[model samples]
Target: MFRHKGKGRRYSHNLKLASILSGVAGLVNITGVLSVNSLTTNVTGHFAFFSEQLFLKNYEMALIYLLYILFFLSGAFISGLIIEWTTKYKPHSSYIIPLSIEIIIILFVGFSPDLIPGISQMIISSALLFAMGLQNALVTRVSQSVVRTTHLTGLFTDLGIELSLLFFHHQKARRKQINKSIFLKLMIILCFFLGGILGAFTYQHFQLKTLLIPVGLLLFALWYDRLLIRYYHIKRKLR
Candidate 1:
């Protein structure tokens, strides 16, 4: 799912990608809220908070909010840079660095909360935002922008537009494509919701350690993809 791009990609690949990554985003989103009372998956809310602070003349708080947005942007920038740079030499495994970085960040925040001062809020929130930014960029490039796992604002908008298109008459081919898109979007939303529920439930018992669930899922995705690649090569050789 992560390796293929353009015509090499397929509906099933995207479906699986959306399911796993969206779930990971959901877990991170909920865990961030529980840990620091901030939306870590996207900067939409942070922009509003920043503007509000500026309006109230709270420059210090506004600067903090601005930093939150910058952290998310930096994550995206660094992930994209790493992917582009590595794609030149290692196209198949270009995603590894960013994905691994994301996993490590979440694991570090979860495991060493007490080791770092102010881990409860600022640091944790910034780390998660950056991690999510990495994930969002990685997946966007992986799927050629066909999938977005971190936030639902755009998903809902796209879903609504596609649903309305269904009401209009169209060619059979276009209709089939639209149906596939709707299914993919719905899967992303459903998985994200499920992940959030699991994250919240686990947080009550495990606190910030709840992030381990998403990290485990991501690790499984990595392992599963590698296994699939080996199986494909073996089958080709046998043939």
Candidate 2:
């Protein structure tokens, strides 16, 4: 049934994975946005544009931004569909499929940068955005939304809110809530910024080949998840 409970000690690993995934998302997004002038992960900016276009009666731009919103929603929807379809039968392996797909796309982008222009930069941007959304949604679901790896505006806001609450309201429940929220938000923000810096440097030096970094991170995540599953299985058997 994949029940999620936040026992302080138990959530550490999930938090770690969330931070790493957030960093990967940030790097990939910055790479795509800088290279193509299109956002690859978060859709907040797209939605804002859509709203402005609607107000200004710019139907053409509105429709374009609306498509971007749909694409992002489609990604999350597909990820959830994958999880729902597989979780009842093979719960442990569902995330691997999306992660694998993302890796392949990234590798293709790295190897054939010209494909972006040939297919139209918008299409390439949408593909990367979809992949990022899928990855972010999967991680968020797995962590029970206690962690979100993409979209830093909310994260930063949450961090500030939590910090303020921690000092203003020292009640146990308030303190605990603030602590957890702040920790997760700060971890995500820091990781994403670090990733952005690394991505910029890598792009400066290696250009498109910098895609390898995200690919490597995904592979590492897969390996780590597999190890955790194996360890849990062994412990269950011993018990």
The candidate scoring highest on TM-score is 1
Against the hidden reference, what TM-scores do the models get? 0.97, 0.86
Model 2: per-residue Cα lDDT at residue 83: 77
Return the top candidate by lDDT. 1
For model 2 the local lDDT of residue 172 reads: 91
lDDT on C-alpha atoms for all candidate structures: 0.94, 0.77
lDDT of 1 by residue, 73-97 (tens): 9999999999999999999889989
| Total colliding residue pairs, candidate 2 | 0
lDDT of 1: 0.94
